[model samples]
Target: MADTISTKQIIKPENLVHKKSAVMTDTTMHYCPGCGHGTTHQILAEVIEELGIQENTIGITPVGCSVFMYNYLNIDMQEAAHGRAPALATAIKRLMPDKYVFTYQGDGDLAAIGTAETIHSCNRGENILIIFINNGIYGMTGGQMAPTTIVGMKSSTTPYGRDVSLMGNPLKMTDIVATLPGTYYVTRQSVHKPGNVRKMKKAIHKAFEYQKKKKGTCFIEVVSNCPSGWRMTPVESNKWMEENMLPFYPLGDFKVPEE
Candidate 1:
């Protein structure tokens, strides 16, 4: 008879392809299925663990599904008012110059209500990382049209689809910030696929590195999906994001400092 190996015998550190980061808390995430926030959080945890900066990192989360980030990431977290994450992050970074500060914010909070704070923070070139999640629609506050909502996108506020003539064009906040002198690095990425997830991780890790160099502000915009909010299945939402959102938001670096 052939010898059989126990499952435990097959499990080894070398054989482990992946494992949940200890930097991430064991608490289950509250993001909707297919939501990009969870994936972004996972990469954030992995980057923090890889850099060995778990204790030195501080996160600011404002109003949105992202506000629950503190529950998932095992790190110091601060809560901010709606659309005020950038402002909070600014203060924290200034007071704790040695600590790595970052803000996890949504499109509504970052682009719409907190536009002033977002712009000013990036403009000031604060030594912090600003992770912007643009799901198109307002996920936590019901399916409402947000500032980043692209043309013809349907939302509770735009059931017939967004009319550019009346609603105005979608704001390219990342592009806006990239032009600011204070921004050292600015890029837009997504986590809808395996490749994109890897790319986002790299971008985030790079941003962290730049922050350590005091390279002003580094911003990463994640074009994410909202399944429940969009009333679409996970698969359908990803496909929709690929076809629709990608064309409008388009993933790639919008800014980088000269070497």
Candidate 2:
């Protein structure tokens, strides 16, 4: 004979530490385990939920691994062309001034092909959020070297490590955007650990808040890990990112509006 557990004992809300955000869909994520995309999606969804703007939010996804952000975030989503998320976001926000618009783009999509759109959008002071994921390589199309790929970093395209003399220096898109006078808030964050996730959430929340104020462009660069693309186990990739990626792309705010 076995004893049955009581409903009260099983349903202890007080002991619950975390729960899935209602803004996320039921579809299982396709990202590799330990990929930061899932964590970023969760944080974004949680921010939308907390701000009670699920219905009024619009998200633009680029043609990278994060292109499926529409499938995960339970909000109105528009698929943008390759490296065109920022432009799409600019148009949507201008057309629907009352709606909250944001773009989710990977390094290749933002720092490389979309460089013009990114720079112009921020230069124009578009009131929208830009979530840039910089994992150093093109995570979706193939682990090709990206504009943000660090020199000496190995990739499918740069099998022998990136040569600065040949490939040019890694573009610091976040810093570049921050330099634009139209940008109101710009920050770089990561989400590999519990404490880091908390900080990322705060940065995301601030971006959204600034959006509501009709402030200039708000940009957030999430220095993420791409274990599958990097050809390393999840743990090893994170370790490498901390040791290698962090130095080039240091975390924290690069620009903020003065009170």
TM accuracy, model 1: 0.96
Tell me the lDDT of model 1 at 161. 95
Model 2 alpha-carbon drift over 4 Å, by segment:
1-11
- Score candidate 1 by lDDT: 0.93
lDDT of 1 by residue, 1-259 (tens): 6599889988988899898898999899888877888888999999999999999999998898888889999999999999988898889999999999999999999999999999999999989999999999889989899989999999999999999889999999999999999999999999999999999999999999999999899999999999998899999999999999999888999997789
TM-score of each: 0.96, 0.95
The residue-level lDDT of candidate 2 at 196 comes to: 93
Query: In model 2, how large is the Cα lDDT of residue 250?
Result: 97
For candidate 2, write residues 1-259 as lDDT tens digits: 5599877887798867679999999999999899999999999999999999999999999988987788898999999998888899988998999999999999988998999999999999999999999999999878999989998999999999999989989999989888899999999999988899999999988888889999889999999999999999999999999999999999999997898
Candidate that would win on TM-score:
1
Clashing pairs in 2: none
Worst 10 residues of 1 by lDDT: 30-39
Candidate 1 ranges with C-alpha deviation above 4 Å = 1-9
